[model samples]
Target chain A: MRDKTDKLRRIAIEPVTRVEGHGKVTLLLDEEGRVVQARLHIVEFRGFEKFIQGHPYWELPLLVQRLCGICPVSHHLAAAKAIDQIVGVETLSPAALKLRRLLHFGQVLQSHALHFFHLASPDLLFGYDSEISKRNILGVLHKHPQLALQGVKIRKFGQQIIEAISGKRIHGIAAIPGGMNKALAPSVVSTLQTSIREILPWATQALELAKQLCLADRVHFDGFASLPSRYLSLVAPNGALELYDGKLRIRNSDGSSYIDQFDPCAYDQLINEEARDWSYMKFPFLIAEGPEQGWYRVGPLARVNNCDFIPTPKAEQARQEFLALSGDPLVHGTLAYHWARMIEALHCAEAIDLLLQDSELCSDDLQRQGQKSNEGIGVIEAPRGTLFHHYRIDDQDCVETANLIVSTTSNNHAMNESVRLVADAKLSGREITPELLNLVEVAIRAYDPCLSCATHAVGQMPLKIELHDVRQGLLHWLHKDQRGDFVAA
Target chain B: MSGMKSAFSFDGIQIAFTSGQSIMQAVLDGGGYIPHLCYHPQLSVHGSCRLCMVKVGDRYLSACTTEAQNGMQVENQISELRELRLKLLEMLFAEGNHFCPSCELSGNCQLQALAYELGMTHSRFPLQYPTRKRDGSHATVFLDRDRCINCEICVRASRELDGKNVFSLSGRGSDTALQINSEDGRLGSTDLIATDSSARLCPVGALVFKQGNYAERPNERLYDTHIISETGNRRPAVVSGGYPELGE
Candidate 1:
């Protein structure tokens, strides 16, 4: 099918669905029907930095959470931390810090559980080449009801934690400049404690399921989208796994450390973002490696690989089992993202349990005052990976400039690379079949790219990639309203 | 200003007020709610928002501007006036940007609280989408003209309470807007200190202090927890943390 009269034909996946935000994948093929290039395009740019420039310093946390519905807590906390710097509060009260940490862990927990069970689980539970009609969460419910229930319960548990701390299931404000707005009530703590009894076991069960599925079929899972470059995440001062607060650490693919104990505020010196003409998203890279080789990976895979060890007991036990996958220090298997993500989810659940017990969780010392500063930066390990929020406020206490590197933005280059590898290997010379088109979607879903800003932009076709057996986008990348039952690509 | 007191039936109950008390203020002081945005108890009645439009006999008058006469049957919950006020409220929303979901004053904004009080599900009118100016030039306050309903409560407060006359209106009709009284038309250039007595009484998100934007949980906000009838005409006190500061 000739879309354009040009020599190269484009097989485009307009609006990759089952992710947080909108994204697209265009596979350019030569006259021979050989896939030559693939580009994951974030068609829309929200221009949040420019939108946030004129806002007051305190509005940063409240305003920036409009970025993504899925990971607003990450944005909320990151912006709050940056505001802390603007307010010149270096350390928060223990209660405030604890509340913020609890919020972050909840964000990661629900996000990972949602990605694995709601979005990515169908592909894991059912084979990649399985029937499009039966390869979804519904299908999982029919086949593996217990596992599916665990996934839903796990996601709910995480969201409940968020609500307990932030006041809402989504877009609730927990963090404020220099502290937290509210502390958990004693009743709320008791309620969370009641819910955790059921959730902790479910989280471990979910992790065990992910581990067993991957380990049983190691060969298929390991090599699927196995294009490793480097990894980056936030770790504690003592080199322990930390999600909420930590220093930036990067590890090379070949058992070497690119950087360690890197100050997050000075990330400008360590990282650089390169813009290309094909995509709206900027490819961020390590300043040491440069753009050509510096494109690194973030999120669960990177966090698990880069961190020295997990802090919580159950997650640490699971991490030990996951690390024994190979003799090498790092796990480069792309599909292991699901496994690594569950490990983190387990850690978050356990952490939530421990935090619920802490007496400081209900303390009223929720805020502190400090002298003000002009510039501030906050970094944290979001569910997707490292999220950075930097701002420079004018003397009027309004934001003059805002520099944000969201988790999905950081993984732009890595996703594109993964798409390219999968397309080149599967669709280069072979006939483009229905199952083959889905393989491309499967590869992209592993990274769980948010493509958040595209929906906000005008004139961009917001199509959904029905890879989760939603009864659409099987043969066609973008479906038209044909009178018939289906539209073929 | 007469010393004698008079009674008037508002919505239902006969609320007693001293002579020269506006019907809106009397209903408010009598623990009754007639949805309003611009009418602050401490400020002079401007009757700009038109949200307090009530049926007084055969005429529809803004309750704040209308004086409460003895035995005057004022209809606060009449269908015609309710529908008219609904449209008026919709116009107030359309004429300006009042995106409460993202607004820092979502739960605290008097305009938002009244909308909920009036059961405003959606606006029937098309948004004017006027290109409004925002003044973040102030050290601690933000002047977002987009969310301004042109109520001019700030104008009255600045003139009457603070005696600063720092806020005033500039245009007429469609072009009417609140203008910051400074050399460059910027809030920063004025004598608008963050601690000015009348600084935080704009009744909207327009004149917002730049601290603790989202300090309260949704259910814990003023409007979320209490109806306008229950709270009367007071802006919930704002605290350093996101909780509302009460006069402890």
Candidate 2:
């Protein structure tokens, strides 16, 4: 018989699935069943930083793209821009600049569509507590075949554009140091223009679905991992929404005025990274606020919250409606990340349409050559958030040092905070069910953290959850089995 | 050299070559496929990769070094040879850090193309994850030893073609590595230049031109659309001697 005095217990989840990389969650409980600590643990280590040291600076655009298959263009362009700085090119040629922008729009569109349709819609369309097998993209296809087809088409269209411009969809080779290595052929441009026009309505439907989900579960949306934190994003020179390149902007948690604005090259002066023992990912915070008080958020929700205006008309309409949810400039609900992602997808489609119409996109003058310098920093807005690539070169132009602050890494602290919040609110002394444990993951998924990019782990994301007590041993261990069903181990 | 040329059957196709030419050379000269890594026409055959193993009678021999005799029947594309080559390619992939996506020579990389040609989806062997050095000490050349298949093309090119012994193989077995000729083992201290034959001799991303990296868009590279076997038409012209014509 079990002792009545054995009050302490523990819970653990391992090998989390349906995400981009390997991660786990651990929960510690006190004698009274109150949660003491909850943490997200990134288990894998990819030595991209260590391996890139001896390579040449010019190889970084290609080297860093290997960091994540889903968003290689973000890293490619970021490394290129940094190299551009090292080459001492103040600005890219007009034609090269437009082509790079077009590539970025394609990247964001594809990634957002993947996250929304493949990962998030499963939980939204089916109830969070529904049968695990039915809560996936396949299930979405089984019930809503047309919607599933649209999702696949949307993602394919974005991938096609990437392939047409660069070469291949996964690790394309187009952007170079000073500019792009190639220009869009007239034939490829015409094909992309037609595809974008056909896909805009589907993007709008995705936005509508997100809005419906948000309205249907207002209470859950309002409280699910909804914590007050500062928002960070990139803004154009005119204070408009910018994804590919822009000035860094910060806004306080209460929908107040701007905290700071600075050039992306000067990121080190404004933002600082704090390394934690549990995870390979580093926590980035505002330099002035310090680590304890400086925890901020980036990504879709943060981008929508911080931007003054989105330039595209349809996206702007979605943004205005999203802002009306709270009647304030900032929306703290973590679930709203799904809504923000859909809105960004719409914006990307509209931006692609506008760029395709530009005659300069078809120009043959692609890249420029320049003198090399000693140091460079490139920053761009990845689908997840702001990505920074910093490099220092030797006299021979070989990379002496490389530092990358990916978008998911920037949101590390806030993600941990959200996990703690969800676990604290949901798991009190009751028996932990798969449904209860999934709520905790919903909080982490809301950030749409790309552990592959954040931890630099190769391949698919595997997640696990653990619950523990102070005196007792591990109470429960839950994780996705080989068939992707959440099973107790 | 003999005045009479030898004719051989390679994978059911008749190939004619000089008496002194090896089976691999005959196959390449005839534009037939037999995967090879170290056997450059301009360099001496190393036969280390063993990817060009072919069935002759009941036994197998390295095609790159085995001479093509008159009426020699070489089973180049048989299932046995194909399986052996696939195993060799898989071993090479597991033995090195061949992260294709991040590699600068992804589409143009000969090793990658050969893998695709052989229908190699993934490596079956356990990855060694060896810690290899990347030497960017050269002013115009970048040497990532991690991707080296030890084809010895650079070694032979430096010694035989460029007349500058800039590279050599060191150690043995798993610990074996490509070493530079400089006292400090740095390319910057060597006489090798960007235009040197040794610099362009690498069949992989191991030795690459620093400035020209990714200059040709990936889609337009040598092996993007077509496999290495189909690149016979695009192969650079071999001059009067054995060496390929320079600056083609």
Candidate 3:
């Protein structure tokens, strides 16, 4: 086959299935042995922030939870907290605050577990080509039924706790602006305590399996390559780690400079987003510079980096292991996503256990019964990362503008960079193998980008590297023998 | 949100009821099942379901139409209303869809249930199906067109309750078909999303479920009315959660 050097070839991933959000990737490469361009695109944009304007403050929890089906509880509480802040409404009681924290932890635990085992584990575990449809948790079920059941049980436990406390599993109404709608009943508390204790062992086993899997697939850990980027999160005034609600802080990968103590209300001033035409997800960066200059990462990596201390002992242990891997204070290694998730899960269980055990949690008085309506802001660490829901309201307490920045958007720059690096390493290599492509795809999945929450942008394909003269691309070539009519790539 | 605050004062207890439910429905829900002759718990709440009427301020209105206020003084079981309700029941039994013996819903009919409560021996009004057909084209449920009372229970249930808009009235006086609008004509044509209100709206044997026929006779089963009315009252605004708020 001729080198077909002059013309350009385009590879467009339309309606990227298996991923949570609407996203596309364009890989463009020239014939020579050099990289060209890599663009990640998010295609759909339903202006939810604009839509949420003029809603009643009481309805913020319900309204914001609509942001994503995958993580409604996070948005619900984030919006609730925001409303609370805007009105200067502290939680009605400690019990309500405790319950809110417990559920938020559950969100983190379950979401992380789902992302790792179900969505992003295929390529690392079964080598990606093990059948696309069967490459789900069901595939794990066929092989390791007990493990799959354990995963399901763990996720269900998280959901059950939320349902038991919040009134519903998905869009829970318990967490209001001032406080929770209802306090945890004695029977429900007892059930949760027992259930959490029971699930801990299963969670431990799953974590062990995850660790083994990570070690087994070291070569595929090219996605774990360290990148120098800033980490952002919310921390308490005393510099203690706070996930529920706190001041924003951004720290560079090196322990050099931490953007000390900024209010979340000033987020619009700090970070600006540039939307591309191709993808639904928008590219967000520090307002100082555009993508080329203002690339930063958030979520697991950022949270751990920004926080000065881990409150829970188990989480601290995992954090130590995380730091040891890279010998760097900030673990830029994406492969550590598994470790970060497990640590967060353990932290969640521990936090919930502590919260449930609180004497205040059993109080009969839950809501701020006699309190007046007020505007507020709720900032929390969603399972993926930092989440902020800001709401402005009128005198009648109707919400004006509701601006939300999900954790996925925080990691947009890092995700693009990670994909670009992996694409360069794998596709630019001497062989354009299926394993390489799978590895590259898996690398992107490691970030667990919720493109639905993020803005969409165009996918610019990197120039192709023709290692060997080929008749067609791998997908086209593989299907040629099976079907009567096969489209050439 | 302020209309008649002190005008409808009880104690100082505020409650949140589901949207679109009537005050009588709300009171009956909170374990105070009000009794009256015109209130046939099921039949499209005739405000005529007036058997459940209570005092709303100085003006006496049907509780089925008047929404519950936070502190409304409600008079469910008053001494003076018993004779009036008995008289209303006597008038209702005189109307159509009251074939006690041959009726499929005989043991469990709302009219029968109310008739037994009001101690009515016989109807005063004439027996009038008025040449109504047994339009039973629905494969699953049979509709005794003659059994329908034209109370618009099925129509309201189909449109408001189920959000399917499958049932509609065809004629004015006595010629209405419980038309399962097929081909946009009857309900069978449109997709009927089964909801509790839709299932509960059948006052007579006008609409019967395909399955569970004669499964549990009314006498044997507990219609204990209080629990039944609780769920009937709290028809959730966003019942299934995921469906957007009604207007949204």
Which candidate leads in DockQ?
A: 1
Model 3 C-alpha lDDT per residue in residues A1-489, reported as the tens digit of each score: 232321222233323343343343445454564334555555446577885554345556666676776678888788777766654666457777777888787777777767666665554567656655455566777777887787777788888877876656776566654667666678888888888887777777776666677667655542454467788888778766677878888887686555778887788778777776655566778787666677677777677767776787767766666666643667766766666676667677777777768777678565554334444556788877888667777643445666677787777767667666766766634445544444445556667635531211111112122222233322111111111122224
**Maximum-TM-score candidate:** 1
Clashes of 1: 4
> How far in Å is the alpha carbon of B127 misplaced in model 3?
42
Q: Per-residue alpha-carbon lDDT of model 1 for B1-248, expressed as tens digits? A: 58698899877688998898888878877767787877778777778778788888889888989989999998888778778878888888888877676677777667777777778998999988765878877767788888888777788878887789789998888898889888898988899776664566767778777775677887777777887656754556662222344220
Q: Lowest-lDDT window of 10 residues in candidate 2 chain B?
A: B233-242
Show where candidate 3 strays beyond 4 Å.
A1-21, A30-33, A128-134, A217-225, A238-240, A289-291, A369-375, A428-437, A452-488, B1-248
The whole-model lDDT of each prediction reads: 0.77, 0.80, 0.59
Ranking by TM-score: 1, 2, 3
What is the lDDT, from 0 to 100, of the residue A106 in candidate 1? 82
lDDT (Cα, 0-100) at B1 in candidate 1: 50
Instruction: Summing lDDT over every window of 10 consecutive residues in candidate 2 chain A, give the lowest-scoring window.
Output: A452-461
Return whichever of 2 and 3 wins on lDDT.
2
* Model 1 quality (TM-score): 0.90
Model 1 CAPRI quality: medium
Candidate 3 residues B92-193, lDDT tens each?
Answer: 554454555324454455555656665667766665534454433343444555556555666776666566666766765445455666774543446664
Give the per-residue Cα lDDT of candidate 2 at A355: 93
